[model samples]
Target: MSLSKIKAPLALAALSLVMLTGCGKSSSQTSKKQEFSWSTSAEISTIDMSKASDTVSFDQLRNTMEGLYRTGKNGKLMPGLATSSTVSKDGKTYTFTLRKSRWSDGSKVTAKDFVYSWRRTVNPKTASEYAYLFEGIKNATAITAGKKPLSSLGVKAVGDYKLVVTLDRRIPYFKSLMAFALFFPQSEKAVKKYGSKYGTASKYMLYNGPFVQKGWTGSNLSWKMVKNKYYWDKKNVKIQQIDWSVQKTPSTAYNLYQSNKLDALSLDSSQTKQLSKKAGFQLINNGGTAYLQYNLQNDENLANVNIRRAISMAIDRSGLCSTLGGNNQPAKTFTSKGVMYVGNSEYTSGIAKSSEAYNKYRKSEAKKLFEKGLAELGKSSITVSIMADDTDSGKKTVEALQSELTQTLGKIKVETTTVPFKTRMARREEGKFDIMVSTWIADFNDAISFLDLLTSNNSRNYGKWSNSEYDKLIAASKTTSSSSDRVKDLQQAEAILLKDEGITPIYYISTAYLIRPEIKNVYNDNLGGWQFKYASVK
Candidate 1:
């Protein structure tokens, strides 16, 4: 699923933000450390893997749950609950050999756990937002659409420790997708015991990963990740506990970091400039894009191609990046760089070079288009409002866009409303805004993660933009067996989306942070979420 709806601030690290103090120490000394204090800008929404659609919740889930596979350093697939797997010659079937593991409650983790979780997620009654990710699995789409029984969904257990999964077609990133939180195993007994209360709080959920979450109420901003003694790989887990807190304001977070209360802090634009020379300052280029999603179904002006193009072209992306500071760069396409490649060359490079007219700042052309659009709509002026998060960076982003649109598109009035992250997401889901400021952090290392969001039938397609040709190309990309043909289809679809200004590309996000020197072995999954399983205090 897409990470979150708010700006990148809510898109903080995927795992716990590790922090520590002290000089280099021996492995033995590090192994004895008790706890590490960490901080994030957003609170956990829900830990239910099936229902989670945001980064913060998924990050926490990654800490406390284990799937068939775990994403290790550099996006490599590591053994989790499954120890090995064999694929059929036709590439439509997979059989996995499981490991002997136990959940925090001391119940054996078996293949039945995976079967139960997969069925629950795809069941129409469950209403999982991420059920669409299972589209390629056999009967998954039909099951999610309520056209098939849950038992027909192609996953089953063989005995106690073997799992068999059948797919309708080959998914190129199938193994990587298995590492995502949505694929984590869920205990039927726990779900039955808690029923509606399942995953609502730490006490109601079962954990099989390196840590067990505690102290998190449904709405609290503080929690703890205590090491799980029942984890199969417990011997390799070093840290005893992780203290997690939320600090939305950059200044407050930075203050805590300075006072040794926090081990890391995500910097704001101004703080990034002021702390570039600090010893532990680092810029994290998360494969994420922040853009503008127009409500095409609800707003008449935004539905017009000319008006959407006008709003897109009027803004100076480079200037906006400068105003916001940090290392953010103007986005040339919806997909960020370093995600996928079309034969050794980055996929987005060719598309960006070809989209100069649409991406470049052209105030005069934008003004002409805006006037023409207004004339065609039989209106002298139009009023529009942008919805964004109430955080400092979110406010700056909308304010800058408002200035550019009103200045370049004369007779157009642009208003801005900034709400808390959760409220803004609710409004966008309800289709209650003219323009919504949105951000997406890829769930995996693939361009499809971003491009799939604009498809006409996508649940995440908040704008409701429709293009038959674009949808066809996207569908073709998935079915074609040839790698080159798939690339061509995706490229053409992205080109169409850009030419029509379906969504205005803003900038690629690069967050800055300060980490103490004593933290070691921490690594980010290729998608940019950090993993603390192997982390140690040194």
Candidate 2:
């Protein structure tokens, strides 16, 4: 799903406001019967995998349409559309064996569907936001750049059941990538039938996964996903339906959960403080990092390394984690914990102590750096605007940062701009803010998923920060034949990024949520959020 939706890491400010506004609201169960129900603070953007970039759309895409593989419990990859696959010795080619399956529209699913979908996503005219994920595929980059035809792409259907793929390099995590939404197949006939509005309404799309969405107009705060009778493994689908409501206030959603209206609910700081001891309270370590992204292209002041470093060190991260209180931990490096590993050793654990210390809070040192930075810029004062989503936690984060900036740098002024989740991301891409809080969720299980975003050429490198040595490290990691060398290259690259303080590391997020004790079989993938395909109500 939308691994990038900020992960509900923080909750709203006024519990009283939610209680008052939601006072007379009845449980969702009062109006309709459903096996499971939940709420999201953010809204779903699109169901089309090619256009969808947020977590909500990813979640919806996983349920209504399937990829080559599916994520099972504990984030393990399981067979979905493809029953099995084989890879060449050098890892440049893959061949998948398709299982017998039918789309909701009663047409048999075929290998050609995957080829058409992939070609459509990378086609320059289509302009899918996630097409960069196909970089290693032959001609994918050229096709996206308008230099080659989509026909030149390396994927082909060897008859109706066999799908072949060729890559430019060894992709160790390709299987995991195949499980992501960007790689999901689409029906050519359906795309041609719906034209430009294929994913805007429930009726315009076809379902091949566990559920079929109904009654969604693409903007409503509520919707339903009914079990797809045509799903290949329908016999194993335990839940008949899932109901979703978009609720921004944490207390309001918690109330819905308490009344048996919802099967699960996300907790804010206040809610977690009161309920962490209760049964069925679960903490989800999503392995995502939230950080401060500098507008390297627009803000001349932000280009000064000393100014960025001063700002990075001013905040009290340990105290911040204590106040926020949902198993949150200060980020010591760019790549989060439990994400990258070789055997039992974590990548960050290898960071030199001096390099790792840059992430800690040091008020006095920051004050000194700020004075020196002011001298270097020859400016008496500066104002910075911090942009983030319009959620309870975002408000709190801004307040904390503003407070810290004032305490550490008396000459600087701090301002905050908040908006809806989708709008925040859009503004970020347009480079409209001085500084913005951005979250990176793992696209696959590899460390490179987090490392590749800032490599100068990537469109997602909104900050416009560049370092040749760091780029070389990443490039070497990708092309080299040695596993040990790749890991070492990544280790060196992270150290370099941290030393430069390219982005200020805040903390790694853990989703603190409440679930009904009787609910069973719900699964969380490598990215945060649940997959309800196997969920059931006791």
Candidate 3:
């Protein structure tokens, strides 16, 4: 994501005046109700939450649906369709009391909607990349493996408004998981009506949340949202409608923002410093992390703990961030900072400390480690392959890394490769490369979401990295009843993961958006993408 772009507020002022002039003719329609819309960098990949994998698809579905719970901007749990929920003392069972809400089609959204959605997401036929998210549901694993019928899964509807969920073990983040798009309620009617095309576009879906997706033609360059009268909490919604556009290039996005086509847009580092001085310009520091990954499954050299450790130690994180030119924080941990808290304390960070800090990036340490790693692998020389995106930032980072490692490590050669985003993902899934630069954004503000990916059985564990002890620690943390105990167990798991060098923690990402001043009340939560539900133009 090359986010470098800047737009002057003077240009935005002109565009806003033009937009307001146009709104004068549409004032009658605007006066009848409230509404706001904004453009995004990417198009909605898909609307079916059940099968959607990437952030873009999930964001669209999030607005059009509801779940048992939802996370607020502060990252706290809040009631969504479910007014209240109860958990058994044993922590294995959960009961949800649903609030009366009607879908966009005027049909009641019930416990059955949730059950159907959950089952559909987990069914092998659906082939959802997120199928593994239901691993804790009773018999869900079996059902996903095709050993049992969907009904065998633990979710059951007591009635139209009550839902019962049984879990194989106690998962402290169960409610948080429900808040994700994958677990949002689904209408079987909508699915059956749309058949294969369900969620492919706006026409194929229904909205149950505070905003109804309007004017989204699946492939349109722009879209709009209207307030959903059907939302249970519609009364609290402030804005009425939002107009949005799609601008993939940050430079183009900046131009749109200047033209008042967008209220706010994410800016790159260059834009940040310049825009920070502008009035009404605010930078939101959200939680997301980016990192370089070495495929332990393919490279015998990187598979050696010393080589991996030496590689991790070789990079100057602060220098790298300076070269990249963003508000990106030098990552001191595998999990992103500000993502989760244990008691009043932030999660522990720093893999092995920066090599520059320890003065260990000298050629002596690199050569020693390289020789030691090569001796262990019974090879005279090692060739490591690096696959990365072709973005300007990516090319620069890879080039710098290629130069640094080759100069430092004697007889150790590093090769760089570039691939498009989708093709790179395919190669990753097939475990086709040696070293790859990859990143993980939080699904719902949980430390485990990233940590759990390294588990042996996780599909996202492309390197097939496994440590039984690490898995046991994570599992124990989930099942433990006490928060204190769970945190301790999780800390232990984190320690093990870091010590073993499964992944090289890179840097925490800072999302920057440049918005036109006319847009107001756009909701942004760290757990999900940007939201326009309560947005309106001035």
* Candidate 2 local lDDT, 1-538, one digit each (tens): 1234342111111210001112122333534333667656666667777787666666677788888898676557888888889999988999999998989988988999899999999987887767888988988988899999999999999998899999988876789888877788899998899998899878889879999998789788778888999999999897777777767777777766677656667677777889898876887766567788899889988888878888999988877766666777888876766565522365655666767666779988888888888899999888899987766666677788999988888889999877777687678668898998776666566777777776877767779999999899988888888888788898888888888888887887666777766666776764554587887766
Give the alpha carbon lDDT tens digit for every residue of 186-245 in model 1: 999999999999999999999999999999998887888889999999999987777787
What lDDT score goes with residue 527 in model 3? 46
Candidate 1, position 297, lDDT? 95
Candidate ordering by TM-score (highest first): 1, 2, 3
Candidate 3 or 2, higher TM-score? 2
For model 1, the local distance difference test gives: 0.77
Clash tally, candidates in order = 1, 5, 22
RMSD of 1: 3.5
Which parts of model 3 have CA positions greater than 4 angstroms off? 1-37, 214-222, 238-246, 342-364, 378-382, 389-396, 410-420
For each of the candidates, the C-alpha root-mean-square deviation to the true structure, in angstroms, is 3.5, 3.7, 6.3
